[model samples]
Target chain A: MFQWSKDHLLLLWLRLAASVCAAILLLVAGFVLLEAFEALRDIGPVRFAADASWHPASEADQGLYNLVPMLSATLFATLGAVLLAGPLGIASALFCQFYAPAWVAQLQRRIIGLLSGIPSVVYGFWGLVVLVPLIRLQAPPGPSLLAGILILAIMIVPTVALIAESSLAAVPEAYLLGANALGISRVGIIFRVAIPAARSGLLTAVILGAGRAIGETMAILMVCGNVVAVPESVFAPVRTLTANIALEMAYAMGDHRSALFVTGVVLLVMVVGLVAVTASFATETTHAESTHG
Target chain B: MARGMVQTSGVSPMTRQPRQRHARWLDGTVRAVVGLCVAAVVGVFCWIVGDLLLVGVPELSWGFLVEAPIDSGRSGGIAPILVSTLAILAVCLGVSLPLGTSAALLLSELAATDVRLVRVVRRSLDVLAGVPSIVFGLFGNAFFCVALGLGFSILSGGLTLACMVLPILIRATEEGLRSVPSDYRHAAAALGITRTRTIWKVLLPAALPGLVVGLVLGIGRAVAETAALIFTSGYVARIPTSLLDSGRSLSLHIYDLSMNVAGGEPKAYASALVLLMLLLGLISMALSISDRWLSRRMVHT
Candidate 1:
């Protein structure tokens, strides 16, 4: 197999390698699709989408998964994170891009990088120490919609700030200068001219941050206080579809286990939808800016 | 580089911004905000590493890593769990590296023609990348464990993890492959070299640093995974003598320990510190390797 001609050995090897790589992709696609389909099939095609009830020990446990509750939890946590990070993240972005000295800006960006690198589990650990203790004094314990929201919100800031900083970077110097030319106050211009221009991209950053939050698992599992009831209140401990699967999948046998797979299917569909939404906006914003720039 | 820089910096001379907005005070405001943002981020850092160090450091010892699971037979040292994590991590690399690199080569070389199969494969890779780890966990358990009768073992778990890492590797490889200059390809082609020869000698070597980056990211993910491993690896704490044995991981060890530790045991903190240290070592090593390789590559070329 070892040959003197770089052409012979390299060409032959690359060809062989590419085929294997293609095979890798095909194998993964085949396996996951098959597994997902199998899970879907067992859940029954007729009632799969409509099932709302998700009890493991009841007669109608096979009934609807009441997905609205879990969906609400996922959406609520994501939205709550955005709600917390939106104003704060944007202000931080603006501050770093236009206001800070070079050294300060670099330092800020480095901090964001370090924050993003820290594991989500650490966030959960911190939340368990500070937040769970705080929540325990007021409520019974475990897996609350509020707890998930608070933890997710805290975790989402670095993501939001990272993307938001980039969008702020993309704003042309001309807009700020042009607005200033028109006698707009610097604060007014930043609010009116720069932000409005960067609106689509900023929205992309928000959605991107939301994706990081919704996709997160470990911390949410730690603090979400995993009661499976529909979130009657934010403080009521409840399980998202993710927590439900994590809690029960290992021990459940047969149908009980299969139900856990169904929960995963739901989470997957939801995540893909979120990914698509964010991706589309991200491309659209980038495309828009490029053409105009 | 100078020309491109000048071109990007040049803008229409239409803007007469107010001197008021450009006052030195704006500089102060910007500096203050950046400082505050950096402070917030650092605050989060302090909270996590500080809390973990304070809470977890006191109980950490070699004994923690060597002990068996106890406390309702559910909590203990994570020797077996550590072994399982390494075994699965090793297995993922074994499966992913060759296949991922090969795919990267194909994408770089043959991708110019834009074949339908290539497009489909590319999209499939993207979908696979986004398919979520938990879904992979479910699939790995069902198809690998239940169907192949591998049960909950290191091999199947690693196989599933391989699938998880494949997309990341391929994507990284694509970036690496693309970063290779076309002039090198042209020179090799002009020299009557085969396409494959040029790719290996001229391209892959050039892309090695990026490949290393990709590998680091993939390894980070594989090591951190808990959900997928929970299903496919099975959470038994043991020093597995074979790949077929079900075992726990550092994260799973943490999970297993926390759930059953009766909430106040010093051992919980000890093992948590061990797991944290394990992660820190992986990250720091990956960072160092990438840095070293990047600097060497820059120097070599």
Candidate 2:
């Protein structure tokens, strides 16, 4: 009886420990909402839709807190990163899985792992030193949306390639063998049979990559010129919502502080949405796999 | 006559030769293209590492690691920053290890009985993992610093890091536990072993590689973090007297030097090289440990 009771106590301890996860989620959401409440109430949510500039001030009447430019910059940068990294990631995954010899495959895997492990700040530093100068030769001002996109693409290529490679690996050997027996060319089999089989996984990889690109802060902040205006072209300098909060939160007060929280709220919502979508896709992939099996 | 007619039909070898050649050409082109993509990725990796080594290595010396910075981090060494970084890492891992392991146990062991609870916890982890680090910085600032009255100190910074790393640690450890073969559990039960003993003796040891990998990865993330640390940790460069004292992290130092301070590039590069080398050492250690463990398991099985 005592042993059983001790086991129960241990289980209870584990349960309490596990509740920290839920507590953290609630605490983060609650605090963000509570802090952002002032801004949301005063700004009326319509201000975010207003295409005006973001000029936060301590005084109530003087400040104009519109997030349009930053929001659009964030979206445009993420889109550019996805477009650039997606094909390259998928193609690299294919090569690693299908075409590479054993040593090459092993080396590629190690490289991808190391690439992902590199700190974001390092990437930002490299961009600031090397990439910015390279771009400045072509465009006078170096730090621009193009710089941010290129850095972000490099940062997320590992994520996309890792997931893509796994999904490609999960494609059943039977499908490949059957396609080969049917006299289809190697490339035809890969494109028509293997890729189609791993379509949902590829989609998941891209979406997750997009999520990472969107949330990334330091690397982009260093590269993307933090000029709070709508970018005219890839070369035009721009600021993202994340960079805005990081730059101003140090000294913000009163309404200005609340505005930053509101920015956080918006970011939290977007990230949560992406997580939900990725979860749904994950379930769909599992369901498909179960049915296939 | 019939044989001659069949040979001249629509699917004859005369027409098939061209299509076969076309398919082969397409195959060759794709092979070359994907190979080039792979080469490009590897080349980028090499370039980044090479650049850092070439520039950062020359600045390294024994004095650089042991002395305190002299002029707003333009010269001198990173001793104080190193101490603070280690202290924060200590606090973070000290809090996260037990909590993360227990959480994984709940998910992996007790999951059979509490389906809804498991799902809720899992979803929360997913959301938390996806939340941006800058947002976490804001949350940490509000909750730990302002509300909890920890202020901008190592305690708050470490706690914030703990929260940020929990999801990764839990998921990785849970995966490790799940991958342990069920036969061990059945055999333990058959031998009349208690549940606690089975967990402590059989399960955790088997899952050590996963736990190690998770810990190393968490360390990597925590060490690399700049945005999340800046607000909670503050930018005080002094060696922290206690957990309540504010201190500077290496990543933050690197950032401030490069961006805010003029003529601080060389110091910044040196600091970055130190950080990079530290991370590389941890990763290689983890790889070797996991490799040895895995090989031992294979041999025994």
Candidate 3:
């Protein structure tokens, strides 16, 4: 009876299941690699990387698949959004975690929850009705990097703010008390002690915000006015890899479509690599904070 | 004599000077700046939601919600869109929960010594989690729809979403499982319970809250999904009788409506509103259940 048990049965199945799991992992990698090879074959590595123009449908377009402008545009938009939303998110998080009265903290938490809950489509709609015209009037062109950046930045704020707040809250109350006892001002304590103590978590929040910005499609598409050229200026319309994929996916045929999927694959690889790096940094920081500090 | 008496005496509370008016002004200014920063973040949320509700409500009518995509808004109901949404949700849950939980169980119970396998699984999940919805839509369309002959059905889209949400679910389940104290396992083992039985009976209940949270987040992601389903699930403006049928989700419906794809703006706005309501309802239930579970956990603990 003991030999006929659940643990024994599970052990019997584990080897089979583990191999299947490994195969499933290979499936995604295989899918991405096959598609990527097709893209390279069509465009070649040199032309694809060096050419800064991406005109899929233009009659007179040279075969330049220069993704530099689009790549920069994506990076700039993400960077711009972080610049706009990151500090403000951190400040609000500080206020929530430390300075705010209890009721205010609860209210702020609730507000952040609600804000994060709003769907991405709704964010795009809001950008469509409000930001699009606003950008057109203020900027040189209607849908430029600035417009996309601003909207994307807005989308990332709640993400950064909420995560930062939670991490800040996780900081041991003892550190703050010690800083206070040393006659450190409130602001100084926050800047010097609290923030540093929660550095790893805060970094994670920022990285997550960056991830959100890069992955975002609809809102950026609505406002970026994807022109598929290297962004000459901040106010110039340019295509992001994400927007490029979304715009072309529906109508693209044969190589045109497969090419778009390859674009997605590239974006995925880039994002995954970056996130891994960020996580490594965060891990080191957390270890340093816990074991060393 | 006067200096000694006055200086050595305890200082009067009243001797301290009031802050200069300039300092006061600076304090007020600094406070205002801080207040504005706080308001700036909060204000955006208010304005966006306010705009949505205001713009969407005027067109929010029984006709818009019930009616399907009509050329001149004469006919078409979101009933079909609603049905498709439910179908996708059901399939998403079914696919993701098992895959996520099984992987999590392995991480918790087995593979205890193999750091390489653990690292690989974690990275795979992380990569999967970070892939954008647009990318998911692309691969999902290719693998499931074209290659496998699932053919633009709810199953294809739902399966894609499952992949999308699997990482999140696994992370949540792992956190939940990690929270299960060693004492419980020891207690079970002391009674000579099988490891699998101990995990099934003791650990799962203990980690239910985190698991619930992960499930909630998964549902939220699945519900709001647009891009992946857009490619694989062809825009059929009908209620799906089964998961096998190609369908349109509420998110897709809203996108089509907003983009005036089928030239149904008002109806799209209504669908957006409906989508918001459904999502909010799911969120509240998830929260309450998690909350209740936590409370019960506290009592039992």
Candidate 4:
């Protein structure tokens, strides 16, 4: 009887602790949403989403919130990163999965592990010192959309490659054996069989990579020229929704502060949406695997 | 036209010979492309690490590691930043580990019987893990700094980072707990030991390795974090005396020195080099430790 009560008490404590963690996440989402509603109350959702200019300082009194230009910059960087990282990441996964020697594969894993562990600030410092100057020699402004895109691409490649490699590795050995029995070449097996088998998982990897790239702030803040206008070219400097919040949050007050929270809400929505998509893809892949087995 | 007429005249294996040759060439091209992509991945890693060491090694001196900022982070060392970074790391790990471990225990032991509860907990963790660090910063500012009235101090930063690392902890620790064999539980039950005692004595020791891995991973995230700490932990360059005192982290030090202060670029590089090495050490340790633990478990089983 004593043992039973002690066990119940311990279980209760554990459950309570776990509930706190869940509650914190809920509170964060709710708190940000509440602040977002405050901003929306003043400016409404339509103008906040569709306005082209982001002149928060000039219209601070009236709260003119324009997120189009910043959202475009964010989209351009995310898309650019996906375009650059997707092929390299998938191909490297192929190398790791099918071609590399065991030691080489292990070494590749270690390198990517270290690369992914590297902090965004360190990447930003490297970008500020190396890529920014390299760009400045050719272009007038050192920090531009191209710099942000390049840095984010490099930063997210390891994530994409790691996930892609794992998914590729998970492809059944029987599939490879069957392909080999059919007299398919090594390259043919990888491209025609292994890749197709891991397609959904690979898509998840790319989506998660995009999510990482878009949520990135300090690195982009360092390389992306914090201009408020619509970026005209890849060389044109721009701000992302994240950079906008980081830059303005320190000094913002009242409705302006709420506006920054609104940007956070937008970022939150996009990331949650990406997470949901990736989760669905992951579930689908698992379901397929279970059914096959 | 002549070639087409010839293929039509002999359309069996004669035409197939050229097609096979073309396919071989295409296969070779694809192989080359894959190899090149692999090289690019390795090359980029080398480039970043090589560049940092090449540029930053000259500036790294014993004096640089031990001294405080002399001229707005231009001429001084990173003593204060190191101390505060370690402080925040300790505070965050200390707070998150118990909460996360208990949470993992709950999920793996108690809630394992409840399918809906497990799904909800897992989905929540996924969403939390995917949330942006900057948003964590915002939430930290509003919740910890303002609402809780902890202000912009290490306490707020640690609390925010605790939130950030909780999902990592729960996921890793839950995997650890689940990996423990049920035979141990059965043996304990056969001995007439209470369930609580069995869990405490049998399950936790078995899951220690996985819990260590999770701990290391959480430490890595806490150490590398900058955005979440920026608002919650105000960037004071001096050594913090308490959890409520604002302090500078190595990550924030690198960010401020490089971006805000003119002539602080070299110091930024030096700090970044240190941060990179620290992160690399933690990650390598995490990998090797987990690998070793897994192998040892396999041997034991």
Candidate 5:
């Protein structure tokens, strides 16, 4: 009885802590909603969302809060980053899994670990000095959409590669042996059998990388030009939703401040949407794996 | 029998050599492509670090570490900024570790892993992990600083960071606990040990390295953050005497120095160098310690 009671007490204590962790996310969402309510009440959701011009600097009554410009920039930059990173990340994973000598693979893995460990601010600083200037010489107004995409691509490559590599490693050795027995070449086996088998895991890697690219702030803030206009080309300056929030939060007051909170709500919604997609892919792969096992 | 099989196939040795040569050429080409990708990563790292050191090393001096900002950070030191960063880190780690470990233990040992409640908890953690730091900054401003009446202080910033890093900590700790062998539990039970004692005495020690890895990662996130801290901590440059006092972090100091203050670019570079060194130190220390611990555990087991 005493043992059972002690066990029960411990379980209760742990359950409380677990609930605390869970409660935090709810609270964050709740607080954001409560704060965003002021802006929604003042400007109906449709008009606020439909309008593309976001000139919040005007007098409070004359303000306009369309988010399409920044939203498109965010999507554009993330998509570009993902497009660049996805192939390289998957290719690197294949190299590590199949082609590289053991020591070379270890060295690459360590470098990747160090890369991911470096802070985003450091990357931003580097981009501000090096990448921005390189872009400036090639195209005027150097802090352009291309710079943001490139920096984000570099930042996410390690993450995507690491995840993809792990998934590739999880591919059963028996499959490789079966391919070998059929006289398939090493490269042929890797492309035809291994990659196809891990396709869902590879997709998960890309989705997670996309999430990182979208959520990224400091690095993009330094190089994305912070302009509110829609970007016409890769060399055009634009602002992301995240960059906008960071750039203007200091002096914004009353409804202007509340509008930024609404922007936060939008960012939250986008990220949650991405997470939902990632979760579905993750579960689907796991379910398939379990049934195969 | 193998020789007879080759003879039966009736392929000349001359044809076989060409096939072998073709296979070798393919191998070399594939290896070269992969090698190029690895080189690109190395090149980027070297370029960033090399450029920073060339520009930043001359500006770093003993005076820079000890002195307070003068002339809007065009000259003087980052003493207060360093202190405030440590204070925030302390608060963040203090709040996160115990709660995260407890939650991980609950999930690994007590709860059924595939249950609805467990699934809900894990899913929410994933969503929390995916939320942008900027959004967290807004939420922290609204909830921690304004509504909770903490009022733009280190306490508020730390609390916000704590929430931001909780998902990572929980995931890491849960993985650690799950990795421990089930035989330890069975053996403890056979010895008439209570479930609580078994976890404290056996499971935790075995899971220590994994937990440490999580701790290191959480520390990294807390240290690197700027936007979230700006709202919650309010960016006061002086050292805080109390938890409620506002503080400036190293990342924010670099941002302000470079962008807001005039003639502050050199100082920003110098501080960026310092931040880089600190992160490198943390990562190296974590890697070495975990490696040693794992090796030692292997020898013992």
Candidate 6:
């Protein structure tokens, strides 16, 4: 009876621990929302939509908190990164799956893993020193949206490649063999059969890559020139929502600080939405596999 | 075209030769393109690491790791920053390990009868994992630094990192726990072992490699973090005497040196190299642990 009671107590404790952790996770979102309420109420949703630049007032009266430019910059950078990395990453996975020798594939996987583990700040620093200067020779004042995109693309390639490789691996050998038996060429089978089968997984990879790119702060903050304008071209300097928050949160006060939280709210919504979409895709993949199996 | 020829009808030997030749060309071209993509990724990796080595290696010395900064990090070693980074990592792991393990246990061990609870926990963890680190920074600042009144201290930073890394640790550790064979649990039950004893002695030992991998990955994320810590832990470069004191992280130091300070490039490079080497060591450690675990399992079976 004592042992039973002790085991019950242990279970109770575990339950309490789990519940507390879950509540804390919920509180993080709630806290951000609660804090952003001040800015959202004061700034008004209409004002955020209005065509104005980000000039947070030091005093009480004169601030324009338009998030459009930063919001657009965030989208543009993420889009550019996904566009650049998606094909390259998928291709690398394909090469590993089909073309590379066993040792070479292992090496490639290890290298990609190492690339992912390199700190974002280091990537940012490298971009600032090397790529920024190289861009400057072509276009003066090289810290532009292009720089951010390139850096983010590099940062996210591993995410895409690793996921894509696993998904490609999940394509059953029987399917490939069936295609081979049909006298389909290897390249034709890959393009037609394997890729089509792994479509949802590939989409999940791209979406997750976009999620990483969109939320990225330090690297984009370092390379994106911190200009408060919508990018007219890839070469144009721009600031992202993340960069805006990081650049100002250090010194911001009152409404300005609340505005940063508002930025956080926007970022949280974007990420959560991406997560939801990925979850749906994951379910769909599993469902399809279940039905087929 | 070759596929078309193969599918449609039997072809004459003369025509089949041309078609086979065309198929070979197509395969070769596709192979070259895919290989080029792989080469590009590897080449970029080489470029980044080689660049760091060329510029940063020259700056590395014994003094670089053990002295305080001078002139706002223009010239000096990173002893204080190193101490602070390790301190923050310690606090982060210290807080996260218990919470993450318990939460993982709830998922892997205790929640089997409650599918709804498992689904809810899994979904929330997925969402939490996707939340941006900058959002985490803001939350830490607002909740820990401001509301909790921890201020810009290592305690606040570490707690914030704990929150950010919890989902990762829980997921990884849960995977580890799940990988343990159920036969062990049955065996323990046959021996009349308590549930806790089975978990502690039989399950957790089997999951140690996964748990260690997860811990190392969490440490890597916390160590590499800059934006999240910038507001929570703060930018004070002194060696902290307590958790309440503000301290600079190595990543933050490198960021400030390269971006904020002029003529701080050399030290920044050196700091980056050190950080890179540390991360490399952690990665290899994870690899070796998993490798050894796999070998042992193979031998045992």
Q: Which candidate should be chosen as best, given DockQ against the real structure? A: 6
Write candidate 4's Cα lDDT for B109-138 as tens digits: 876565676667778888999999999999
Top candidate on TM-score is 6
Tens digit per residue, CA lDDT, model 3, B90-205:
89899778767777877776766656766678767766677788878877887888889998899998988887888878887887787687888888888887777876789888
Model 2 chain B, poorest ten-residue lDDT window?
B1-10
For candidate 4, list the clashing residue pairs, or say none. Answer: none
C-alpha lDDT values of all predictions: 0.69, 0.87, 0.74, 0.87, 0.85, 0.89
> How many residue pairs of model 4 clash at the backbone?
0
Fraction of native A-B contacts kept, per candidate: 0.27, 0.55, 0.29, 0.62, 0.56, 0.60
lDDT by residue (tens digit), candidate 5, A215-266: 8998899888999888999999999989988988888888778888888998
Residue B210 miss distance in model 4 (angstroms): 1.1
Q: How many Å off is the CA of B259 in candidate 1?
A: 1.9
> CA lDDT of B143 in candidate 4?
92
**Interface RMSD of every candidate?**
5.5, 8.1, 8.8, 8.0, 5.6, 4.5
lDDT of 1 at B269: 57
**TM-score per candidate:** 0.82, 0.95, 0.88, 0.95, 0.93, 0.96
The residue-by-residue lDDT of candidate 1 on B1-301, one tens digit each, is 0000111122234653466436435745755765575566567667766777887887666776677656532445656667788999999899888878877776767786646646666766755666656677877887789889999999989988988888878887788778677888887778877666666678878887778878877887787777677789887777888999987777776665555456633555565566555666655655566657666758867
Output the lDDT of residue B37, model 3: 70
| Evaluation by lDDT, superior candidate among 1 and 6 | 6
Error of 2 at A187 (Å): 0.8
Model 3 DockQ, alpha carbons vs. true complex: 0.38
Per-chain TM-score of candidate 2, chain B: 0.91
* Number of the top lDDT candidate: 6
- Model 3 chain B worst lDDT window (10 residues): B1-10
Which regions of candidate 2 fall more than 4 Å away from where they truly are? A58-60, B1-16, B288-301
Q: Across residues A7-100, which tens digit of lDDT does each residue of candidate 6 receive?
A: 8877887777777677766989999998999988888777776836678873544688889999999999999999999988999898788877
- Positional deviation of B204 in candidate 5, in angstroms? 1.7
Q: Give the residue spans of candidate 4 off by over 4 A.
A: A50-52, A59-61, B1-16, B298-301
